[model samples]
Target: MRLRNATIAAASAVALVLAVPTSANAATGDFLYKVGPGIPAGLADPASGECINLFGATEANPAFAPENFTSSTATVFLDFDCDGDVFYVMNPGKRLGDRLKLRSVVFS
Candidate 1:
């Protein structure tokens, strides 16, 4: 009986450990961009492997001049949902010109 109880407790502990979700890794540093003619605004320590829509972004007034300071590569999209054929892949510590407009971004 004692051995059976111990086995069950060990199995339960293992199951619990396996069921716990792990945290996703994030890109370190800021992802800066400008809205219209405004000053640069950014996300600090943004999460990787997720789509991030720029704040206050729209078709007429999209975010532009992206500066990717994060450790991972960033993909900027012309659409809010990170979709469409218009996209730019930016390397870490790199930046784009003001002509490059974007509404969403994803990091790798």
Candidate 2:
């Protein structure tokens, strides 16, 4: 659902919008990218078949895979701060909230 800022009641009031790109890019190889938007909340299980191997990934930092998220697939990416529910994507000018499907994906 696309949530408008509460203060936009006035007709003259300009709505603030954040423009986020629909796609993201991550490097390839050993770097374990923290894939999110999996079925269950939290990092994906390495054993699960969804993880992608980020070439030079590390515990603190990991290589990631780019995702082409659609309306049905928001799959927002976040750091450890997304422990509970909801995460903020730094992309600018985007409206609507897509359920984050956290998945730890590995690639060949």
The alpha-carbon deviation from the true structure for residue 33 of candidate 1, after best TM-score superposition, in angstroms, is 0.3
Q: What are the per-residue Cα lDDT tens digits for candidate 1 across 43-106?
A: 9999899999999788888989999999999999999889999999999999889999999999
TM-score of each: 0.77, 0.20
RMSD in Å for all candidates:
3.1, 17.1
Tell me the deviation in Å of residue 99 in model 2: 22
Which portions of model 1 miss their true places by more than 4 Å? 1-24
Stretches > 4 Å off in candidate 2 = 1-58, 69-71, 80-108
Q: After aligning candidate 2 to the native by TM-score, how far in Å is the CA of 59 from where it should be?
A: 3.1
lDDT of 2 by residue, 85-105 (tens): 533332212333343232223
- Number of backbone-clashing residue pairs for each candidate, in the order shown: 0, 32
